[model samples]
Target: MAKDSSFDIVSKVDMPEVTNAIQQAQRELEQRFDFKNSKSSIDLESDKIILVSDDDFKLSNVVDILESKLVKRGVSLRALDYGKVQPASGNTVKQEVKLVQGIAQDKSKLVIKAIKDSKIKVTASIQGDEIRVSGKNKDDLQAVIALLRKEDFGIELQFINFR
Candidate 1:
C-alpha cells in the first residue's frame, strides 16, 4: 500500500505585511501633494480597511495607494472585497474594504467541484476554513494545485502542509 500525498488549501493573509502596507500607504497619503489638504485617510480596522476623503475621487485615490502598497507587499488584490463608496459626515466619502481571510463554504465547495471535474484522482475535503486534498500520487496532487490555480475563486488561496 502507498501513502497518500496531500496538501491543504487555505485563504489567509500575512497580517504583518498588511500592516506594513497600511503604514506605507498612510505615509504616502500624508506626503502626497494632492492629499495634503484633502483630509484623505486610510485606516486599517480589525477585518476591514476604511478610506475617507473629501469626495469620491480622493477616496478612490486613497484606495489606489493602498492597493499599490499591498501589491508591493505581495498581497493579492482579490483578497480585498471593496464596498460601495458612501457619503460621510462633512461632505466626505467613505469606503470600506473587507479583507478576505478564509475560504467561505461555497467557495470551498467550488474548489472541490473543480478538482473533481478536472478528472484528477484526488480527494478534496473541506476542513473548517480550509480544504484538504489527498491523492495517491504526487503528480496528481500537483495537477490538482495547477487546476485550482487556473480558476478564479474570488479569494487568494495558499497551498500548504504538503506531505
Candidate 2:
C-alpha cells in the first residue's frame, strides 16, 4: 500500500524578524524630522507590540513606519492584528498590535470547508492551530495547495512539512 502525501498549513511569524523590524522602525522614528522632540515610541512585548505617540496623527505615522519595516523583513502584515488607539499616560495615544501565531479556529474551519467543497480526493483535519491535508495522489495534494493559494483566508497561510 502507498502512503499518503501530506502537507501542513500554518500561520507562523518569525519573532526575530519582528524584533528586527521594530528596531529599524525605532531607529527611523528617532531620526525622522517630524518625530523630532515627539514622544513617539514602539515597544515589543511578548505577543504584542505597543505603539505610543503624543497624538493620533503621530501614532498613525508610527504604525506606518513599523508596517513598512515588517514588510521589508518578509513579515506579513496580516499576522499583526491592530487594536484601536486609546489614551495612554502622559496624554499619549496608544495602540496594541497583537501578533497572530497560528491558524484561528474559524479560519481552520474555512480551510476544511474549502477543501471539501472543492470535491478533491483529499482529507483535511485540524490539529491544534494547524491543518493537515492528506491524499493518496500527489497530484491531488498539489491541486489542494493551488486551490488554497487562490483563496483569501484573511491570514497568511504557509504550506510546510510536505511529504
Candidate 3:
C-alpha cells in the first residue's frame, strides 16, 4: 500500500521581527534630517501600524522607511494592507497599515482551484487558515508546491509540515 505525502500551506509572520522593524523605523525617523521637528511618528497596536506625519510627503517617506525595515527583517511586503491617508490632530496626516496574517476563506478557495487546475494528481483541502495538500507520490506534492509558488496570490505562501 502507498502512503500519502502531505504538506500544509500557510502565510504567517514573525511578530517579534515586526516589533524590531517598528523600533528601527522610529529610530530612523528621529535621526533623519528632514524628519526633525516634523512631528512624525509610528505606532504598532496589536495587528495594525499607525503612521503619522505633518504632510503627505513626510508620511510617504515614513512609509518607505518602515517598509524597508520590514523587508530587512524578512517580512514580505505583500502581507501589509495600507489604508487611506487621513488628516489627524494638529494638522498631521495619518495612515494605517494593517498586517494581514492569515489566508482568508476566499483565498483558500483560490488555492484549491489552482491546485485542481494544475492536474498534478494531488488533493487539496482547506484547513482553517491554511490548505493541506496530499498525494500518493512525493513528486506530485512537490509539483503542487512549485505550481503554487509560480502563482501570485497577493500574499506570501510557505510550505511546512511535509510528511
Candidate 4:
C-alpha cells in the first residue's frame, strides 16, 4: 500500500512575537510627541489588547501605531480581530482587540463539515485546536488547501506539517 499524505490546518500566532510587537508599540507611544501628552495607552491582557484614549482620534492613532508595530514584527493583521469601540466616562473611548490563536471548537467543526461537503475523498479530523486532513493522493490534499484558502474565516490560516 502506498503511504498516505496529510496536512495539518491551523490558525496559530506566535505569542512571543506578538508580545515583542506590543512592547515596541508601547515604547513608540511613550516617545512619540503626539502620543507623549495625549493620555492614550495600550494595555495587553491575557487574550485581548485594550486601547484607551481621550477621544476617538487618539484611539485610532494608537491602533495605527500598534498595527505598524505588528507588521514590523511579521504578524499578520488577520490574526488580530478588532472589536467595536465604546465610549467610557470622562469623554474617553475604549476598544478591545482580540488576539486569535489556534482554531476554536466551532471553527474546527466548520472546517470538517466543509471538507465532507466537498466530497473530496479525504478524511478530516479535528484535533485540539487544529484540523488534520489526510488522503492517499497529494493532489487531493493540495485541492483542499486551495479550497480552504478561498474561504474567509477572519483568521489567518496556515497549512503546516504536510507529508
Model 4 over residues 53-131: C-alpha lDDT tens digits? 8898989999999999999998999988899999977778999999998999888888888889889989999889999
Please give, for residues 68-121, the per-residue lDDT of candidate 3 as tens digits.
999999999999999999999999999999999889999999999999998889
lDDT of 2 by residue, 19-49 (tens): 9999999999999999999999999999999
Q: Best to worst by lDDT, what's the order?
A: 2, 3, 1, 4
Report lDDT (Cα) of residue 59, candidate 4. Answer: 93
Name the lDDT value of residue 148 in candidate 3.
91
Residue 122: error of model 4 in Å? 1.0
Lowest lDDT 10-mer window, candidate 4? 32-41
Model 1 worst lDDT window (10 residues): 35-44
Candidate 1 Cα lDDT to native:
0.92
Off by over 4 Å in 3: none
The per-model lDDT (C-alpha) reads 0.92, 0.96, 0.94, 0.90
TM-score of 4: 0.85
**What TM-scores do the predictions have?**
0.96, 0.98, 0.97, 0.85
lDDT of 1 by residue, 49-106 (tens): 9999998788878888999999999999999999998989988999999999889999
TM-score of 1: 0.96
lDDT value for model 2: 0.96
Q: What is the overall TM-score of model 3 with all chains considered together?
A: 0.97
